[model samples]
Target: MRARFIFSALATTLIGTAPALAQDDLSVDQVLGAWQKQKQIFHEAQSSGLGQTRGLKLIAVEGVDAAETAPQQGVSVTASTDAPTSTDTTPMDPNKPLVAATATTTTTTAPLVFGQLDPELQVNLQIKFGFDSAALADDQKPRLDKICQAMKLSDVQLFRIVGHTDTAGTDTYNERLSVLRAKEVARYLVEDCNITASRLETLGLGERFPLNQDDPRADENRRVEFQALS
Candidate 1:
C-alpha cells in the first residue's frame, strides 16, 4: 500500500509538469519568425559594413527549435534525388521482328495525271492494236524493240507507259481497252528487255490525250507512248 501511494504521487507530478513543458515550447509560427529575424540581421550587418573581413573566420550559428523540428500532424516531407526509369510490362516474342515502339509515318505528294511527262522527251511508240481488241497485232510487237533499245541507251531510271484509243467505242470500253494495252506494253518490256516492272507505270488515256486532235477517229490517235519520269 505504501509503494502504490508513492507511485501515484510520482505520476501526478509528471502529469502536472507536462502542461508546463508544453506551454514553454515554441510554436511553428514563432520558430519561422525567429529564423526570418536572423536572416534580416545578417543582411543588415553585411550592408552596414560590420561583416567586413578582418583576417578572421566567419562562423554561422545554427539552432533548432524543437517545436519546428518536431513532426507536424504526423506528416513528413522528403526529397528524392534519383531519376525515374520506365517500366514496360509488355512481353516480347522472339519469332517476331523487333521494331520501335513509337513509329512516325511521312506522306509524300503524288505525281500529276499520266505521271506528267516532259513533252520534249516523249517517245512516240506508235504501237497499234486491232480494232475493238486489246491484243497486240504481229506487226506492232516489233515497234517495242526500238523502245527497249532506247530505254537501254538512255540514262532514264523510270518510264510511264501510256495507252491511247480512238473514239470508236463507249467510254467504259475504251478505258478498259486502253488499260489492257498499257499493261501489255509494260509486260512486253519487262519480259523481252529484262526491264524491272517497278521501273514502269501503266496509264490509260482513252481518246483523252491524242496526237491528232483534228479527228478523234484518226488511226494516229490510237497509239501507245513512253514518257521518262526520272
Candidate 2:
C-alpha cells in the first residue's frame, strides 16, 4: 500500500509540471532561424523593384559591381548647308554664318540615401503590471512621465507601440494579451497625454523576443517599446 501511494504522488507531480517545463524550453537556434527568415523576406521584397510604383525606390538595387556607362559618351551631332556656288565658301565673315547649331545632353545617377531605421527615436517604455489605474508602480511614474514629456516636446508625427510577453501561456493567448496591453498604453498616451489618434500604430510580438531566454517567464522580458516618426 505504501509503495502504491508513493508511485501515485510521483506520477501526479510529473504530470502537473510537464507543461511548465515545455513552456520554458524554447531553443536559441529556433529563434534565430525565425529572425533570419523575416530578414530574407524583407530583403527580397525590397529588391523586387515594385516599390517604384509606390514612389519608394531602392537606391542601390544594382550593386556596386554593376558599372554604368555615361549616357553622352562618344555622342556627337553636326549640321551643314550647301555652299552658294562656291562663293559662300569664303569663311562667312567668321561670325556672320547663315547656319545656327546647338547640342543638348543629359545624365542621371541614383540618389545616395538608403532605407534605414531612425536612430534617435527608438525608445523602450516599460509597462509593468499593476492592479490599479496605473500600469507601473508609483515609484516608476516619474520616469515614465519624463519620457512622456520628452515625446511631447519633440516634433513627433507618428508613434508605433509594440508589445511583447514572457513565454508563459499558449501562443494565441499571449498574442492577444500583448496586443491588448499595447492598445491600453496607446489609449493612455492619446487621451491622458494628448497624443493624437492618427499618429499611433500598434503591434504585438508575443513571446518572440525574450530578454532572458534561459528564463522565459521573467517579467522583464514582457515589455512594450515606443518608436517615434518625425
Candidate 3:
C-alpha cells in the first residue's frame, strides 16, 4: 500500500507537468510500460512455383493493449516498472514442412483500416489547429513535446504517428487535413524533439475511426495518436 501510494503521487505529478494532454490519463512512465509490441514473423522458404511470393509471413502481431483480447503471443505490459516478459508461446507443429526460417520481424483484430493503427496508446488530446487549416498552435507544441519524451523513453525503437479528425468536413478534405496534421506532429517530433526521421512513420485516418462513436464530430475524435512498434 505504501509503495502504491508513492507511485500514484508520482504519477499525479507527472500528469500535472504535462502539456494540455493532461486531459488524458497518460503518464511518461505509463507510456514506457505499455509501449513495446511483440510479433512472431514466419519466413517461408522458396519453392519451385510462385507460392513464396510473399517473402515474410506475418503469423501474429500483438498490439500494445492486446494482452487481454490478443492471444498469449504478445509481450504483456502494465502501467508499472515491473513489465511482463514474453517468451516463444507458439510451438512449431510437427506436421508442417521444415523450412529454413530466417526469423525476420491494429486497433481491430483485422488491422487498422488502411494499414496498422493502435487506439489504445493514443493520447486523446484535441491538438487544436487553426480553423480548417493544418497549422498547429504554439501552445500545443509542448503537449506534443511531452509525447516525444514518452516515445523516446519507450522500449520500442520505431513509432507510428497517425492523424485523426472530427467528421465535420467532406471525406476528401478530412483525409487531406488528417495527413497534414499527422505530418505536422511528426515534424515536431523530428525537428524539435530530436527524434530520428527513419524511426518514425506517419498515417492519416481522416475521421474514419471515431473515438466517440455516438458523436463522430466530437473534439476527442480530432486527435493525434502515437503508437509504439516493434
Candidate 4:
C-alpha cells in the first residue's frame, strides 16, 4: 500500500511538469518562426490591405516579439548611422546680366514686330486696328502712311492685321465683314504701300473679345490691331 501511494505521487508530478519541459525545449528556429508569424500579423494590421481586422486580433495574441523577429528572417541586419545624406541639386549661375548692354543687341533681339507692325507704332496711330477704315477716319490716311514708312525704314519682317467689329450686327454677318475688312487692308498694304504679300497675315475676330464690355457698340470696339513678327 505505501509503494502504491509513492507511485501515485510520482505520476501526478510528471503529468504537471511535462508541458513546462516541452515549452522549455522548443528549438530557436521554432521560436523564431512563431515570432515571424506574430510580426506578419502585426504588419498586416498596420498595412492598408484587406484582412486588417483579423491581423489585429492575431497581433493582440502574439505580442511584439513576433514583430521584432520578422526583419531578421530573410537577411543579416546591420546598424544604420543617424546622419542625413546631403545633395547638391542647385544649378550653376554664369553671373552675366540677362539683358546685354548694347543698342545693336537690343534692336536685333527680334523686333517686337508681329505680322508687319511694331507695338510702339500703335501709340502714334491712335487706332488699334492697323487697317480698319471704320475705326480710322479718311484724314488718318497720312498718319498710316507715315507709320508704314517708319516700319519699312526699320526693316520690319512680318505684319499681322487683325480686324474686329462691334456687336451691332449678327454674328455671321460681323464675322464675314471683319474678315473682308482685314483682307481689304492687307490688299491696300500690298498694292499701295509696296509691302510684300508674304510678310502679312490677316485675322478677323468678329465681336469675340470686346475691349469695352460696357459699350460693345463703341467706336473703339470696331477696330483692328497690328502685330509685328520677326
| Model 2, runs deviating above 4 Å | 1-122, 130-143
**TM-score: which is higher, 2 or 4?**
2
TM-score of each: 0.48, 0.44, 0.56, 0.41
Stretches > 4 Å off in candidate 1: 1-112, 115-121
**In candidate 2, what are the lDDT values of residues 1-230, reduced to their tens digit?**
00000001111110111111111222333323322333333344345532331211222322111111111111111112543231222222222212211113233343212221211212445566542121333454443454456456554454545566888888866765565456556645665677666566555556755555678898766776654422
TM-score: the better of candidates 1 and 2: 1
lDDT of 4 by residue, 1-230 (tens): 00000001111110111111111233334333333443343344335332223312211111111111111111111112222112221221223111101111111221111111111122112343333222223554454564355445543354445666889878756665565455545555665677776566555556763445677786666665554423
Q: By summed lDDT, which 10 consecutive residues of candidate 1 come out lowest? A: 1-10
- The C-alpha lDDT values of all candidates are 0.44, 0.40, 0.47, 0.37
Per-residue lDDT tens digits for candidate 3, residues 75-112, read: 21111223223432233232322111111122333322
Per-candidate alpha-carbon RMSD to the true structure: 43.0, 29.5, 19.9, 41.5
Better of 2 and 4 by lDDT: 2
Q: Write the per-residue lDDT of candidate 1 for residues 1-230, one digit (tens) a residue.
A: 00000001111110111110110133334323332433343334345443432211122211211121111111111112232112321332323222111112232232221222222223455665555455555677776665666566654455556677888888767765676567667766776687766566555667665556567787767777654434
Pick by lDDT: 1 or 3, better one = 3
By TM-score, who's the top model here? 3
Model 1 has a clash total of: 0
